[model samples]
Target: MEIVNFTPVPALIGGALIGLSAAFLLWSQGRIAGISGIVGGLTKPVRGDLAWRAVFLIGLVLGGVLYRVLGFGVGVDHIQPVVSPTLLVLAGLLVGVGATIGAGCTSGHGICGLARRSPRSLVATLSFMGSGLVTVFVVRQLMGVGA
Candidate 1:
């Protein structure tokens, strides 16, 4: 697919913010900013670990809301789901499985792991990118879906 309404500045700012937040989380909490791990930990509900995870998840939702409320054009205003809800749920589940098998999500492996120069993260990131590319090719080209 083709990229529509690509805005480099906004993308750059978003990336920088993500990086900063990840770094700060690591520095302060001594934890990886992996969304999957954070969420998964909640399932087990370790006594002392609950608060931070809940707050982090809340902050994630609030961040988007704040972005939209502040008139940031790059938030959710342009999001248009191209696939069915069933397909989206299937995709999310598959990603969750992949993250489980890979030992970490993209934020943990891609941003934090890469920054620490972990070879496993390198391979994991490559696999994630390759799988994404193949999926896009299959969905957009072979299946003739999405623009």
Candidate 2:
């Protein structure tokens, strides 16, 4: 399969959409569009609060599904990650653990928190970015673990 050529248009569009969504959520409901917080609220949901959270999570999943179904990105092909299954599972587990320990996922901290001028989220976002950079350096540059 061919690696897709890079372009800025789609990224800019996506970012604008995300910002608009966040702003709309804040304006309409006075709620931050943080995925982790929304999803987490589902676990011990209060009456009348569960519906929106479930809808948000479902919309998140359906976005990707819709994208693929409509022939965007990798089109209709089943696009698998380049990493091994074991590595993928481990990475997912690590992200979940980090989100739990850090009290928010990247979307919560990076997008919503930064927008709200949160110092803790700033720190968490920076640390996560740094960790990601180091991991990429070690995995790709040091270990030569890629296609």
Candidate 3:
């Protein structure tokens, strides 16, 4: 697939959206905007909570669709990570496991946690980022694990 360059504008906008969503979820529903929890809730959800969770997720997907429908005005087509397919999959699995063990993903722990001044989530966010940095240092610098 073709890759696009990374620009600060899109990243900042996306981050703002995430922060907004997390804030809205907490204010409106008293819930954390952790993606995994939302997906997990689908398996066996409490009566009233299910609808909102589904709505939140649907809105997320629909936002992308709306962006595309609006002609994707941005110059960047897509941002692609520099990693091999196997390593990418491995990284994704490790991130999923880490998020599960930490009880939340980056958006949940970093943005939401910081907003709420949650010490545990803050620590989890730092640890998660540190691990990622160390992993990249080891794989790319030491082991030469990818191209």
Candidate 4:
């Protein structure tokens, strides 16, 4: 098996930026920077509350656009989706269900919740990471995908 190169600097910078964003949201707006919570709130809007969520989601989309425009992750393998679109959609639905069941998404549990030392977040984050590892193992080793 070919080992993947790990770029610590970029990963560290990205993680730091995410933490900063979460911290800024909490510090400034007294809110958790959880995508599912934000977007779910959008589905059932309340007066005087939908604007920030819309702005946050829009910023997320624009960030991806800016990243693509800057040609980040251009030629490196493993960046592109390996699964079929149907499977991708199914996986997304499952993730949505999982996030709902778990009461938060990865950002909520992994970053903000952990920073606040929440026990629920600890369990949620561990389960999230463990499931991810299992999924990759099944896809790559058991299924011989992208091998």
The TM-scores, one per candidate, come to 0.90, 0.84, 0.77, 0.87
Model 2 scores a C-alpha lDDT of 0.86
Residue pairs that clash (backbone atoms under 3 angstroms), model 2 = none
Q: Which candidate is the best by lDDT?
A: 1
* Model 4: CA > 4 A from native: 1-3, 68-79
lDDT of each: 0.90, 0.86, 0.80, 0.89
Give the TM-score comparing model 4 with the true structure, all chains together.
0.87
Clashes of each: 0, 0, 0, 0
lDDT of 3 by residue, 1-147 (tens): 556776789799988988888887888888988887786677667787688778878998898878878898363365577787887898788877777778887778788777889999889889989987998789888988653
Q: Choose 2 or 4, whichever is better by TM-score.
A: 4
Residue 10 of model 4, lDDT score:
90
In the order shown, what is each candidate's alpha-carbon RMSD?
2.0, 3.5, 4.4, 2.4
Better of 2 and 3 by TM-score: 2
Q: Best candidate, TM-score-wise?
A: 1
lDDT of 4 by residue, 26-133 (tens): 999999998888887887789899999999999998877887788864744347788889889989999888988897898998898999999999999999999999
The residue ranges of model 3 lying beyond 4 angstroms of the native Cα positions read 1-6, 43-48, 73-85
